[model samples]
Target: MGKTLAEKVWDEHVVRSTEGEPDLLFIDLHLIHEGTSPQAFDGLRLAGRKVRRPDLTLATEDHNVPTLDWDKPIADPVSKTQVDTLRKNAAEFGVRLHPLGDIEQGIVHVVGPQLGLTQPGMTIVCGDSHTSTHGAFGSIAFGIGTSEVEHVLATQTLPQAKPKTMAVTVNGSLPEGVTAKDLVLTLIAHTGTGGGQGYIVEYRGQAIRELSMEGRMTVCNMSIEWGAKAGMIAPDETTFAYIEGKPEAPKGADWDAAVEHWRTLVTDDDATFDKEIVLDASTMTPFVTWGTNPGQGVALGANVPSPEDFSDPSDKLACENALDYMGLEAGQPMRSVKVDTVFVGSCTNGRIEDLRLAAEIIKGHKVAEGTRLLVVPGSVRVRLQAMEEGLDQVFIEAGAEWRGAGCSMCLGMNPDTLQPQERSASTSNRNFEGRQGKGGRTHLVSVPVAAATAVRGTLSSPADLVPAGV
Candidate 1:
């Protein structure tokens, strides 16, 4: 009968509740991007309504901005128009805007946490599906549609039917080469793409507790890919430490008080979930998606699944379609699968920790012939920090192109895209057909795998780069 973390956060944010109708939940923070805010802003104009709480709203240019040129006019007219409209709208609406070239400008999800705007026990919504990234702090964060965007902008609240809760307990220690990315991919493979439908998953247990805040963010970031409304991990010491000195975080006496409250934002001992599942992290291996969807993945050493491997007719057909589109075959080995590019950045894996991991593996090595490597930071702050620590030089010297911060090569919304049929190993979340570019093939990977793949010109891992033994 106890409350789960999601339930607790939801109940606290309810502005109004009515029987047989959705509750109007107060939105603590609203994140907007160029891709989804244009229409919402127009809606506000038509209604002659102003943003109800401009202080609680923020906007950034990511989806449509070019990552390479900081000052050049966006070449694509559609992309340029979108970016321009957001700036004009933000200014007119009095919402804080982080345009390209601003130190804070980056992926909305990345900007939120980097600035300490994402906190525990608060409700956050964005137009991007990866908004669940903020739930790493035990917040009730999820993506909203364009209409909902306008609703939140006008009222600072959202109407919602509460989702069922699911507890995903990851126990045991991860192996040396495994990472949060691998863990999440493995989870998707186990649960299938629709496993978390109509639920907000709360990741728990020993292994989840042991991950860093960055690692936890990576997990929660991909919750949507598995059909979950949101994903979260309870706030703990690690979460507090990460937020301690952040620019938007509380300071001095306020910091202490905030932590005291965040500490209480956990599931009660007897809290019951609509469903529960357990995963043993120690048994996991480096994982990658072979098919178009995230769930069609196997371990790094496993073979591509044949269509017949699926017992269900629909699953079998889906497998066949994915294999054809991916230009892969049944029983094909995942290791050494050739790639044209290796992209090391995204909301899911574009933070400083992710950059450093890729840099460490890429140091003293060069990208393989005919393979292009791109190291894009998640935010301008992360980019500056990476440069301060000389991570840029490490990547540049290793033949990786060091670029400005943005959601490059993540969704192919900008110039950072793949040529037709070009294959890539990327750290981004989705890998659906044409997700990276028209006719492009993407294999979702971790930083280590992405870096190693660049050097070997194939889907690989750190262990593949290292000699069998010293």
Candidate 2:
């Protein structure tokens, strides 16, 4: 039988395979950050082993790094220690380190692709769940536990059972106001949170092909949120164009050779996936999570659904709890929901392209008086690029806060967090309870939706921002 993309990538990286034993696959790139590497480094210290391939390993300060005045000492000792420990370990172990002040410093997932370290036909692992973001380049990328991190540090190989392959084909074209984020949210809602379990999902068909590299990354970035082992997108001309001139990308003949290999990485024509799902993109609308979980979402035109609307006992219970926590009522129009914070940044949507879209959509529009709009770039490089384009000024003039690069407001790790009972229309992945902070409610949204929500101070579709009859 012809092979799927996941199988092809897995088979190419096998170092050892035994009957009754998990295959040992060599990892091409191992990305690490402050929060998750300390213990892994400690494991290395106790074993007195150096990083087997420091050249292939990259580390940076994120999670706890402040988006504002990052150069200043971190106020939280635990956060400071994690950053300090990572720096000490990276320097001691001779690994390439990008600290807060470094131009290359930023979220690991964002930095990898931006710097060209993430590429097609590679096996990548990070100590972060969103590492699947790198899979946008057609690589087999996934997250590892701390011990797994240590194992990769020492051996650069991981033992893994093969996951089944699944295909999510979105036919036709997405509606004007819909985004890659909306498409992925619709997928999760179709399959629920555990829908992709034990599978490596390949996003294909017309709508996916129409997406730019940035849009592809946004879809793959949230794969983990749907319980997928990882996500994969077949490398194509668009992928090559995005990586061709990056700092770590190959030059001249090397580049040509790399592209040749990547071209062969797609799933075979006769390949059959273990599971399949098909959707009509034209029917998908911008999604907003009325409940805490991402799967508990509905269309922009949808109303808040009652728990009793669900058939499954677990889903019904979850819906009830989510509604109570989010302070929402059934039968209420989603557009009527108000928000105090509108965050535009995360590994999912903090890229340069995302920033540009949000800035363009929100230009000349004042943020609502009671709303706080925070626009943060994914990396220092993205931050500098935005400033050069004066996107920062556009946001500032519109009453939004132009912040530095980091995973701000995506979770409670950094200083940019929502307070008790505070609700936000966020571009970040995950809307779990306290994902932003204790007693905080989150509604996952696309960049354009978050941009419009900031101006309206309510959950809104991007279409609502347009002047009528335009």
Q: Each model's number of backbone clashes?
A: 0, 0
Which model scores highest in lDDT? 1
Per-candidate TM-scores read 0.99, 0.99
How well does candidate 2 match the true structure in TM-score terms? 0.99
Tens digits of per-residue lDDT for model 2, 1-470: 89999999999999999999999999999999998899999999999988999999999887889998877899889898898999999999999999999999998999999999999999999999999999899999999899999999999999999999999999999989799999999999888889999999999999998899999999999999889999989998899999989999999999989988999999999999999999999988888889888898998779999988999899899989999999999999999999999999999999999999998888888899999999989999999999999999999999999988888789879889889899999999999999999999999999989999998999986678865235
Per residue, candidate 1 scores C-alpha lDDT tens digits across 1-470 of 89999999999999999999999999999999999989999999999999999999999998878888779899999999999999999999999999998889998988999899998989999998899999999998999999999999999999999899999999998998799999999999998899988999999998899999999999999999899999999999999999989999999999989999989899999989999999999999999999998998999989999998999999999999999999997998999489999999999999999998998888888899999999889999999999999999999988889998889899999999998899999999999999999999999998899999998998999988863223
Model 1 residue 150 CA deviation (Å) reads 0.2
Instruction: Record all residue pairs in model 2 with backbone atoms less than 3 Å apart, i.e. clashing.
Output: none
Error of 2 at 187 (Å): 0.3
